[model samples]
Target: MNPFTYARAENAHDAFALGSQPGAKYLGGGTNLVDLMRETIERPVTLVDVTGLSCEIEERAGGGLLVGAAVRNTALASHLAVRTRYPMLARAVSSGASAQIRNMATVAGNTLQRTRCAYFYDDEGSRCNKRNPGQGCDAVDGFNRYHAILGASPGCVATHPSDMCVALAALDAVVHLQNARGERTLPFIDLHRLPEDRPEIETLLEPGELITAIELPPLAFGARSTYRKVRDRSSYAFALVSVAVALELDGDTVKDVRMALGGVAHKPWRAWKAEEALRGKPATAESFRAAAEAELAHAQPLRGNAFKVELAKRTLTAVLAELKEVKV
Candidate 1:
């Protein structure tokens, strides 16, 4: 690891000031950033600790929730309102990493976590465009069983690794950000960028900007939501394919739905096409299967990860079928 100066900021003002310095990075829980630093993938001259900032989970005035960026993953997953009102988010958080890591991982850190592509992490042996722009991406033609099938470009085939993000995407969560200039909000789905030619750039965040909170809009069907993850292992494993969905049915007819996919794209893929196809359609296995096909119609699978297309389709159909049977 590189020699670095560390400073703890107790408030947002202090965080912003310190974070604006040259080669400075805001530290939330240091779950992902610290590892990247150790691997020499991220080298910052200074670390501005922001874990002391807002950690509250406040209910919005009308409805919804405002989750502080510093809120720990365990806390967020266990919050009464989250577990009861937004079960998908809770389940997704619980499905990530392990209990120890979850205890230390913050909401913002998880939101900003980088991809876990093996090629991207092998700093010395592999050529990763995401690690160094225009250098080339080994994962594209390498062992790509876990690579992206959607929104992947010639420069990079990496998949975003956050399960929490999939649920956030489905919930239509908004990210609250602040920098030296001012504050702004971005839709959660728009936060991450697909790896195009410039695979190095990940999120759309402005330089030195800090994530303050994530706001989840009110969805009456949120309580009916669930998250399902399929991985090579039972625990401490990233999803090979994951689905987060919120379903609302009116007597076997789809009234409303929201769905997002993980481990198959550069970012959490909001299944807008599938949702569009399902509305007003009968809540049957055939309709669910057709919706899944519509969503994956444009998916361009890689050599090793082509099975993901069928896996995604089957998982989407099964999840919807399971939700359809639930008494709502």
Candidate 2:
């Protein structure tokens, strides 16, 4: 970590003032940023602490939930309303990191956590366009089994590593942000950017913009929702292939679906094509399999990660199969 100035914000206004700088990065729980800084990957000369901001839950007029940016991962994931109404989100959060880390990680920082791509942090390699643009990408030819398959350009192939993010994408949550320009709300799907050569720019937020809150509109899909993660380990490891699904069924057919995949794209990969294929179709094992097949028709996997296409499809199929039973 570099010698830096520290400002503990007493309120949102104070936080915004310190945060609205050209190169400022907000410090939430510091679970991810702190680690990256120690490795010298992030060299922010100023750190603005936003932990003092109000961290309470706000209920919207429509029974929706607006979670504070300072809300800890544990609190957001285990809230009575969240656990009972957004079980997919609860499960995703509960499955990540250890209890200790989860207790300190904030929901906002988790959503914007830097990718765990090995190439991005290995200062020695420096081939990650995300870490250093225009140097060239080593992951394009190196060990890329965990790299992206969708929305990837020749410049980068790192996958978004947050399990909670995939769930949020499926749920269509809105992210609230603030900067010198005032406040704005962006859809969860549009918040993050794919590599597209300009891999250094990972999100739509302007520099020094502070994430204020995350709001999830009320949905009745909770009963049929599920989050499934397959990883190298059963406990506390990143997803190898994960699916977050919330499906609405009409008798033996699909009415609506929310499908998002992690570990397969630079951003949360929404399987809209697969959802399109399944809606109004018979909700059966065979139908689920066929939908999975259609989802990967456009997938362009790299040499080491080609198997991810089949694996992701199978994982999603199993999730849908489980959801069908839950819907019943």
On lDDT, the leading prediction is 1
Which stretches of candidate 1 lie above 4 Å from their native place? none
Question: Residue 33's C-alpha lDDT in candidate 1?
Answer: 97
For model 2, give the RMSD to the true fold. 1.2
Question: Per-residue lDDT tens digits of candidate 2, residues 34-145?
Answer: 9999999998878999898768878887778999999999998889988877888999998888999999999888989988988888998457788888998888898889
lDDT of 1 by residue, 1-328 (tens): 9999999998887888899889999888888999999999999999999999889999997689999989999999999999988999999999999999999999999999999999999999999989988889998889999989999999999999999999999999999998877889999999999988888899999888999999989889888899999999999988889999999998879999999999999899999999999999999999999999999999999889899999999999999998887665
lDDT against the true structure, each candidate: 0.94, 0.88
Please state the error at residue 175 of candidate 2 in Å: 0.8
Error of 1 at 218 (Å): 1.1
TM-scores for the candidates: 0.99, 0.97
lDDT over C-alpha atoms for residue 223 of model 1: 87
> Where is model 2 poorest over a 10-residue stretch in terms of lDDT?
17-26
